[model samples]
Target chain A: MEVEGMPPARLREPAHRVSPRAVRYWTVNALLGNVLAWAVMFVIAWFLPEGRWWSTTLVWLFVVAMLANVVEVVVEPVVRYRRTRWEVRDGRVFVQTGWLSRDQRIAPLSRVQTVDTHRGAVMRLYRLANITVTTASAAGPITIPCLDTDLAEAVTAELARITGQTRGDAT
Target chain B: MLLLTPVRTLGSFAVPLVLAVLGVRRGRDEDPWWLLVVVAGAALAVVFGVVSWAVTRYRFTDEQVQLRSGVLSRRVTTAPLDRVRSVDIEAPPLHRVLGLAKVKVGTGVDATRLELDGVSAAQATDLRTYLLARSRVAGGDGEGAPAPVDAPGRGGTSYLGPAQPETELARIDWGWLRYAPFSLSSLVVVAGVFGVLAQFGDELPIDQIDVAQDAWRWVVAQALLALVGAVVLVVVVGWVVVSTVTYVLTWWNLRVVREGRGNLRITRGLLTTHSQTVERAKVRGALMGEPFLLRLVRGAELSAIATGVGTGGRTRVLPPAPRSVVVQVGHELLEEHGPLTMAMVGHGPRARRRIHVRHQWGTLLVTGALAVPTYLLQDLWVLGRLPDWGPPGLLVVLGLVNALVAESAWRNLGHGLTDRHLVVQTGTFMRTREVLERAGIIGWRIEQGFFQRRLGLADLMATTAAGSEVLTAPDIPLDLAVQLAGRATPGMLDDFLV
Candidate 1:
């Protein structure tokens, strides 16, 4: 086992990984959007539907969704920060994520065949973009969604550096 | 030249049109209930046919070929003649009867699958002959002598033209296939026939079986005898037929002319023939397809990346060749005496085997899972409340198939990465030995998912500078997968983000 700040000798860091701000951005957006959705559904039900009463259908949907939402909310405070943690080691990059189930991914910067950045309208407004580091897996490409635009650029530069030095990267 | 595109469209629509008219005729066969649907369908089909007729048209140029179609969403594709890797003119049974054939020119160009679909046999031949000459002259440097208009077969070869003949130096042994346990068609027939019987629940109607009513008591007894007889009669004869046909069609008048650079000029055919002019630099890598049945028959298909041969990541290499020829021609293609497939076996002995086993699992699992809804609904409704054994049985059979593959993967997985070449030899059938130069490799990548991470596995895929597919090394160890990916050369990973 390796200590903090000291990467394992064999492991190499990817030039960049998903940053904290990007994780926070997606989480907040999803949370706010979900909360607004439930509130709207309740308002419509309470006002309309001609004497709408609590029923099994509503109970089943709302209760299950609400329960799931609560679980997420409870877990977010403890784990949201972790979602953005990225570590660069000597020859590898490691990232740990998930609010409910912890997930960690490590990629050698040399192996990153393609480092790309994508920006959408909403992301552009917030100066945020998604960065995907692609490897030839055949299953699909690996994407790291929602990164600061500047961070994406930095990641690209760092990846290019590794690829140049190591000559690894197949798009 | 008859425009069969229009004829094919008209013929296809005519079937339903006749059906619809019969269903809707007021004076005779009119049925009130089916009238609306029949009329609507016929009308829609006619409209579609007319619209399609107006859209499709193809043009040939000295430098390229263009096929344009679609009306509202007009689509046009142009393949530079220079980019064309191989042109196969296929004449199906019906095509032979009609004196018609289709020319499929593979440019190894893009994902659109851009192809010139319909052309006359004469037209296809003329086009093929012209393209062969051009490619030959264009050769390795790509721009050489002016392409001649007419080039004839040198000797008494059939459609191979005068230029390319299956090489005499190339090796092929048809007689050795007598002992093959895995014959391609046998497996297909056995699997297909047994699967159908299994679906009907092993209860063959006496009429269907010609004579059977007892439980498999006597059946098993006969089966043992039948297995021996079938191996001798059916399997052996069937494999002989397959190898004979393959040799005749692919290697007939077979000649391999060594050209400038490492390119090989190959042309051979039986009745409906094909001619391919390939450049050494253009071939990405070689792949050997070893179907289980083919393994038994000692049959194997040698395929390679003619990167610009066809659209949508297609490789134009060979119609399945006899194991003998595969070994022989493979040597010339790889410019090495050793088996190419064995060279691809993964690092430290078991790497390729591990990768092959793990990767195949994903395909089998996904296919099995995707059929769940069918299993669920069938059991819930018509299949009775009893547990549906179809999906589970299928999974078991799939597992059995994978076991065979595992054996092959285990025995064959050995890759020798030399400075100039990446030689991969990992196949049970026909012993697919392949050799690829490292300089020819353009792109490579490594990837790991959550499940893979948990298992501490990854994949290293390498693509030649010329081909569309990246030769996959699935389930490469995490460290090595990354190392390989990191070391992939630039320009190999074009459009990675895209």
Candidate 2:
């Protein structure tokens, strides 16, 4: 099928890439949260009766979580950043990104209910913003995580324009 | 000012009042002040009702309907008349007895904007009719393009207007009563029976009688062969009586009529009267649903995929009827040639294989999960509770049943695209054949899971702003799925593909 040649590269690269600094911001924030949680678990483990089933379980959990957090915070963010892509044109918005399974969603601007951007403190520090486009579909919002603030604004403006152009008929 | 404010207020407190009275009667011997307590509660209720009545206010403007209420934290809401998609009125037995009804105004955006709890029945009807007429005018001008005012009496034109003469489209026929026992509505009746028993259970000496224990003894006393037959008989008899009663209550006096140019008005219910008006313009297509049991009687349910109804998928344009009746209604509603009653395009052998694998695996996965617990707790552990060989025998029976179901589902799976519309049919227990207009489709989604990809299968979904939102044709070949997506809305796949 002609579609065979249409996927993978263009699907992920046609849209503006999210800020590269997103990986560092996400990893640092995730590591901090994991350390804080581990501290609480350590305190609980100190009070637990020595050599009990729960104590051993907690010790194993702490070790496994520490490793998992390192991989999740350090590795996953970089992979996700590379995979994420979004574009808005004409009467449609396209997003292609997923952790394991490649989920490509094309939401018509006519179905879009809201378009908003968010910048958390960490993201703000990294000069990055996230744009979320919500359609009336029950599949939930289509989000473009960690883009340059100016690009996010441009995307939002373009979306608004498309939404206006495609308005009236569907409703 | 609403005339039924007092009645509406009383309706709010009726449930609590009944419970309070029941509690007082039950505690009469224990507490001498029980009657006094009930009287005091009633007095407080009256005071609250009066306060609420004084605060509540509602009015209609040229473009919007405004409502205000609440004693301390006042909330004022305005709903644009044009945005209003449906105006539904319902009256429970209590409201019917008092000649009052509840009015719910919905704008497809929000679930329900305004609900006037108590209004005189005649007032409810008048309000509904007025709102519907106004809504039709608003919707026609809503798109900023003047809707073409086609001449009425044209065979194919769907329009809404004040001058359009009212004509009865369909009404409830008791001849379809035979199909009631085969409907899922019977399950609702069974649930209602349980609900009634649970509500009055404490006063009924149910615990003292130990019905469960008695039933167990009876089952033990009966021969195994006799037990199966008796159980089947009881279940079938109970199902028939319950379903018949439920069907009557839900569909009693049901009627559908074309009142205005593009408005279809439906009035139904026995114990709880329901009146709903849906704009014909918003109707994208019709879906004919036939559950496993209903299939035996050749009865099908017809529901409209219309916008602004806020019903999601429960938008029934016609009740369960024979295949011919449902098809006729479908044709009349869409004003197109029998889209709902089409000869479907069947899938290839590969599609059948994919469906069989999909259905069989789903059933086996569930059965395997159940069997694992039975093996661990009963067989391996020798709990002696389950009869020997019972669990394994049940597993075998389930496997056979699942195979038949998978085969049935595979046989039913098909999709066809015509010049004006697309028809997709699938399902095992709940067979649904949806017919959607080609133009109503707004977008497309193509999905292929791990197993599906391996099987060279893809699920294609046609997304529309209205109706079910997404109509999917599952387990079709990847190439065909792509073709269907392209055909659903031309050039939609081109941008994404390149």
Candidate 3:
């Protein structure tokens, strides 16, 4: 996008995508959340009186939920997988994520305080891991999720090595 | 040390003791079970205080200061002398009466707060000077050499002697008290007072007071307009008095001083004096606050954006004062005039139109919500027939107010870049101009929502460890956002830019 009297500028997509297996992992996560929400609605509907205005509302809500469940499980994961990207260069780590609302972050290696790899139970089952790069800023750690475990480990190690080579305190 | 335990214990439990005594006096013949509980709690507190005091031990070595305490599970905290960022001394009313002060050592880390809870006031002063001096030596020399022990005024016994040379930056001015009422801090105090009164209304003898009864009768007799005028007059007078008193109690004798080693020391408070020190190297920026009311009177407040200083890592450098004085102090704090005085680049017409649309939509949503409920309830017998014009009138008034707010917000939206600092201004009610050092920025975050993307706009934030963590320029053109981030921290975003 360009503004008057200013040079046109743009940010290129980061170089790497998360592992392909992330689609399956995200699908399962979304299904689990949908099931829990649907179960709560069913329980409420069971207690509600029949032939009331709310009962009809609940029936309509069920239809909406079924359609939303399809979108969440079938469509969101694929779009998220396509959009998420990350890259680590000479002195900086760049991240881009989110399907609907795009976000881009850049943190210099000299300012990096720590790096860690995390794997949840389901992620472990899928052999996927997440890497978190923390800096002194409270905007919070930059997370690259659903990477192959070995790739996550390599990224964490590389980040640590690069951050360690710098001399000043992170803050 | 042992004698201080009971005194400190009783001081903290004074309110409970009074309540217990009142309870016993009211029920002369009844069992004093609650009093026993109160006494037992006080005794437990004293025992814990004594035991903790006995176990606590702190020792300062050439390289590190270590403190060890705890009976069941001992934990030792050690901080390197070179990393020391500040040393603060505080004396509450009771502590001052006992000639004792509490010393807190900050190392620019949030978790570990090394505190000496109770030390003789004189000893506290000596310790502050000695520790700060050692930190200065270690920081300036870039070596872990032991600081000299025989420096003048370093000895613990000579605390009453002349202090180190200091340059005064600012001090409290009585003329600034005029700005207190405009600050509206007294409204908070008044609300708190009303809340407490409500909580204990039944226990008080307010209804029995003849003067209160007479006042209520007079209020009921007055016409509606006269009553409103009287209430407003009372509120304005009360607000002026309360805010002035609060300002004096909080900022009496306030002084900002620069010590020989460049540490900024701020001392203030009447009953509970506070002495805070901020390391020169840790200072990242300055924030100039111009609340709408204060701005009308051409006044502003200044605060320091420093690491590990005060709550939220911000230290008030000046109270509500003249805008010129605020600018002068800000210039001194940042050690430059360009960032504070530079002209800001506005976000242009697109951003202004975006804010107007957002605010108008908000006004429409609120009006619709309120109108639906009011319309539904208008014919109900219980509420009496409501006026037909209420909803539309509300829409007209709120729409006008929000339009003004949107215009003001657009005018306030601007950012500037100086050689060493990036300045961003935001907010409407309490507009703030933040001048943050480019060197302090650790990262950049560029966010674009669906609407923002369609408008080719983005919010650019610079993340740092000091003061609020993130400083943002909202609704700027996407290209300008990228350019600002790239130029602020050279080469940090170059690899990602196309």
Candidate 4:
């Protein structure tokens, strides 16, 4: 949430972080949608109905949309703070995060189907990447966003090892 | 062909605009309106050319196929050959004239899409052949690549993979015929022709039959007759064109080739071409389908159940086929009742299939509940007489019909386990027959819901090792369902892996 050039101490816990790309990305959707919505409300108020109720309703909507900006700004960071936690336990990756209700997801090396690493422009600047682990349950790839380079690779190798070990038992 | 699309698109757009402009100069009354349209269209032409040049890019490789396009928001999607289920080629009549065709390569990925737009027909066939070969291959098996088939004169030899290639393998495509009355183009032509006929029919030079208050009924009947006649005429003509065109397009190129191991390649196309390949190991479950109408009329279709590899698991391989061919191919292409055959190899209890047959009652009940009301409202309420609760009377009748439907579903149900094949067939209207290979089943589980638990029943779901077809016996007797699950599983991986 801070601008460039802030002290490293200004950096809070890594858990309190959002995908800088996702933040920039979602901001576009929110900003564009708000503008489009407000513009429509404005046009409707100005041309249609032609009464005080219309004008007042337009003013109320503008106030509400303006108020929504505050919430829109704070929502992701608040979410970032509450749910973000990544820990490695016994060579397996466990991610615990959810806004309304927490969900603890564990990906053991043995069950890991494939490991995918992805990065976007914003993460490039921050020297960060996201690692995704898929499994057999038809669940989406569990993405651990903003991992250190060495850590992600280590996790990938570890997961493969675990998957191999478990597969060995079945064999 | 790569150089032709932009030229062709430009030609199509430019020709009309130029013609309109020329016409505007030559003609007097239409000048002003035509000039505006020509100017606007010319501007459109420039935009299309720029976008086409900037965005178009595609690549095909041994490992994967990639496509990238879009002007404002570009997208790049790649499908790995290792995960590919099939590569389909389509040719519209326009493609026949152009000598180019479209290919859709599917890897069970979320971003699966059409790739290699408008490759030459021969190149499209070659690409399909290569991908199908790739699907049969295990990673890094370079020895048995494409040589066996390419060396056609060496017919006595066989390709390497899993199952033996049977000389009498069956593959029948009735799609060319199915498209006759059911084609989208045919439907559109019928609608358009009917609209034209209806408009022209009213002005037909027919003598007036009557001039009275009650004559309106006769007049309405005549109009209805004309409308019906128009519809039949359109359907007949459109069916003739579509079926004939499809036959010409497909029958000549019809081919079914068996390659090394258990690979089946089916290639057919008229203008825009199509090819389908199914490897034995990848074929999890094979099922036959015929909607009620088709079943009554003796028509059929086929589908494959396979794991949506790399796709996060959300796809089914449905290659439409003829009924008789389905029965023949279902037995040949995959293990008949594979992974579930051990307990029922021959004259075995077949208890699992029988239990599955019993489970059809649930779907029967549900179908009955849904259909009863529709029939009553549409069929019984012809007279607009309201008896306090007018809709309720029909609603009651609808519920009764749904009950009848459920009864039919249960009565018509059939299942069997024979000669190591586990077969579960069920349907009220159109039937579905699933054949499984006991050894191929990867895993099995017995799931219990509160309602099922209360009813002393459970769900038995099993997966094949290849992660394709998932066969389930829902709402079967708990004891039997559990027995089948255990039987189907039976240390499944121990026998297959490592």
Candidate 5:
């Protein structure tokens, strides 16, 4: 990958991993989704006539779906939790996320349009919340998913204060 | 105002009117009960329009412009005068005939408009000038107020007067019409005509018509090759004529003028005239687009990347015209020559190879998928079976086409940085060179797929509030991407950069 007169492409990882409880939350979410899908598959299988060509195909598909779901529930959450990192410093927000395919975003505080927090029923049970920092760019709001509820609130307040102090409209 | 209501009502009921007329002709002896119903509807519409007009009260103070309307459920919309971004004056054919125009006051916020329908043309012009002048003064550029020119038809008014002199930036060249067919806008028009015809296909006596059979017979009489050539020639000529007419209708009397206080006023359209005033300060960049066909002819189109303009905030500044004209207009609009005309740094051999691999892989996957189905279904139907060489032959031709596209895409893959703008050019079919102001970039997003990361490449996107929202420099060296972001914003990315 080395090239003449070209510096290596590298980005410093952001500070602070998401709340550890996010792994548990994600696991439960994945399990629920898997269970619902499996239920639908079972219902379809039950109605299938015996010895049909597709009956065996559906069974193999069911097995593959189960294996994939197992990995999603057991492995992906932990990997995502370890990879996701975010920081609000130097009047800017930096977020780095994803396991295999990574993305790093940097948005200045002056460009922050709104800050909000969300706590779903499952998130509430895990005492976790998600904070969304929005800018005028249509790329969409930056979601710092699965933080400790209090930490999420504090971050939202801090972002709101910093954005409020800036003068010009976010655009 | 009284005439406007009935005309609008009648216009909306045109389909019903036609059906009623046909019904009357079909059954002349029957009572014309539908006419009475139509009269009643018109009367109700008139009453509603009159009452709404009478109830609507609009007033402007130093701070805000307030409009209060509605008889049953009162509503008030107030926009701060200082925030007024643009004022558009439009007069459709009916409105023009009635000497009335629609005034739309934009506040730069998305989709929030204060519309005054059916105002006297003179009053609409006055409001536009007054609002724009106030916005300019309030913006505090220190230029003070523009000199007020007397309104053409109206004599002394305290609040109504046209704003300062305008300098014409560009006018319709007529010669640009040659590039219209290449633009493919007429293809859409032609498709729309066919779509409408297809919608009424069932009603038309197509099955009973012998024209199609006669055409087939006529084609059979001629040499197959000659018939194909004639059809192609006819289609191409037809497209050229249709596109030219479409271009003329859309861009008739097109003018881009720089008005006092730096506002760019774009006035165009033939039957339904439209005049849009773009606040100069809101313009963030310029986008020059060269479609594949247009590029072959050395033609390009230009657009202003501004807030609260056209959809996605891109207002066309130049119709498809000579590349030289586009470049000149782009430079003028951006107030910078380097970014638009500078030689851009290509994304290196790795990016070029990546494009080839991607396009070739895609072509292979598509052809493979089709070949597999064709092979499997060979016994089921005669048409399902391809000849021994057909699959490979199709693949080779498609592969060659994709290779050409990949080469063009790779060549177009470049980015440049000027003192004030970050320029990124990419795309194969519609090659776009975006010159985005560094100041307009609000954020940066660096994305790397697994393979891209392995290859030390990343897609660097500068997120902005202007046209398209994000401009991407795809598959640039990761370090270069970072450097571009840091240099463009100067210290914004310092802490994050390794």
Candidate 6:
């Protein structure tokens, strides 16, 4: 809350939590992917020689993986949706997300390279869009997924405008 | 004046000659006609070199230098003189003998865009002076003359040096010679010398040589008492000698100076001289690389990350120096003292626990992966089987070492924040501390892997346009990461509630 022209303690703006559709979006994405992987593991385990040390280890691993997937594909998405949030201010962008390891990221509006919006099949069905904010980082772009389409568009336009103002200006 | 340069022809021939010699190596019954192949390769190389030299043509325009060169496909390169960041002239021993030099014109964005190899010394100097003058004039901030033109009648119209008033900042100190052996360069030199000697081992005539024979005899006699001790002593002595020689050759008479418009002009070399001008405006920050051995001796090297400046050797701003001197030089170059002098804030207990866990898990996984396979495969091989307890004992030792290193690494993890800069301290062996201006940070990345997420930890990376382009703070709590990112560039995260 050290933004320019703002008081230090006043106006503690709460983060905008992502829409609930994100939970459904991520849960389906995770379950479909993990189920297929788990099936392959189970098939491999079934074909293993019985009562051997390696086979027994495989069985134990498969069981652990199943439990892990249950948490990851089902319970994790809800917590993740609750955690995912983004906020736009006068000259910066702040995003926070993560269920187990929470990440809070802030990008100065001056350094914003580009703001892109996209809608996949699932997102389109849910009338949602994902806004990806790209900076000059090789780690990849910052994506805010499963926001309402209108909100996503508004954020994109606002970011583009802010970045345009600060473009080519030295710090 | 427009004739092909002889040095270019020799350079082109070198690769083919080496390949031809390698192909015609001493013993190969199947290749009795190797001489024919070698001759053909050399002839081909000569033809290609001649053609390339003949085709290449360059001319100086009013605002740009355009070079066209290609035998089949016409490749034209246009370098704007005003944008020229550096004009480096290099003359190896052979080129020096022939009074020729290689000129490299760098714009800093694309690094070197034009290289005029094997030009006469006079031409190289003229080009360097003409290009550098225009670049300095363009960068002069409206304080100097607009531009200086080269007169056709005069042979050497302008002095072929830095285009502005210069002041020497630092030069090679003989006292710093002791620090050379501790650098990685010494290890490289030792390794290279060993490789060459090993390659010619059969031709060495060791028994025929009196000194070598005496040395061997001494080694053998010493080995009777303690073989390992004798070998270790020889290695240590050899390492010191090789390292010192390498350091002297590379850093002899090194000079760093200030050029026009906040540009640093560095010139250093033993046999082949190198000069480069670095614009400080493009510099994001400076990093101090302190290797384990160097740190123990309280020594470090400084490098700055600037746009278009390649990392590693290219970014080096200061040679190996004591901590106090390096810090002073760094502060002077950067013109900021806050970030360099700020006290660092350490990570929490959870971060330490995470590091410990990671080390433990890594040790377990590696031992489990390697030891089991080795044991199982040992019985299949005819060689002697390892003792049953060996793998577990080795694993325990490795685990202890890993634990110790993990604790040290966790202790080293810290970050410092000033009003206009952020400093991140990291590294396990080669400890690197980077001081970057907050204004240079373009964006931030927050990453949380599954295990890290489970521990409520995250890594926040500040993305910039200079150096390796990313400065990361790993294993910090989510709340702290938020606060840190906000504090790093104050106006950026005002609306975010952590």
TM-scores, in order shown?
0.59, 0.79, 0.88, 0.55, 0.89, 0.76
Residue B319, candidate 2: C-alpha displacement in angstroms: 2.3
TM-score of chain A of 5: 0.91
DockQ scores of all models, one per candidate: 0.10, 0.23, 0.64, 0.03, 0.55, 0.32
Q: Which residue ranges in model 5 land beyond 4 Å of their true spot? A: A1-9, A45-53, B30-41, B55-57, B61-63, B67-78, B139-165, B193-234, B377-384, B388-390
Worst 10 residues of 5 chain B by lDDT: B151-160
Candidate 5 lDDT over residue span B272-366, tens digit each: 88888878877889999998899899999998888665357778788899999889878878878777789988998888877888889988887
Chain A (alone) TM-scores for all candidate structures: 0.62, 0.81, 0.91, 0.59, 0.91, 0.83
1 versus 4: better lDDT goes to: 1
By summed lDDT, the worst window of 10 consecutive residues in model 6 chain B runs over: B1-10
Q: Which candidate number has the best TM-score? A: 5
Error of 5 at B118 (Å): 1.5
lDDT of 6: 0.72
Clashes of each: 68, 5, 0, 31, 0, 2
Provide the lDDT at A102 for model 5. Answer: 83
The TM-score ranking, best first, is: 5, 3, 2, 6, 1, 4
lDDT of 3 by residue, A1-171 (tens): 344665666788999999999999999999988998888878877788888765897888887987989899999999999999999998798899888888889898899988888999999989999988988787847998899999888888888999999765577
Error of 3 at B149 (Å): 7.3
TM-score, model 3 to reference = 0.88
- Descending-DockQ candidate ranking: 3, 5, 6, 2, 1, 4
TM-score of 1: 0.59
Task: List fnat per candidate, in order.
Answer: 0.01, 0.14, 0.79, 0.00, 0.64, 0.42
What overall lDDT goes with each candidate model?
0.55, 0.73, 0.82, 0.53, 0.82, 0.72
The DockQ-derived docking category for candidate 3 is medium
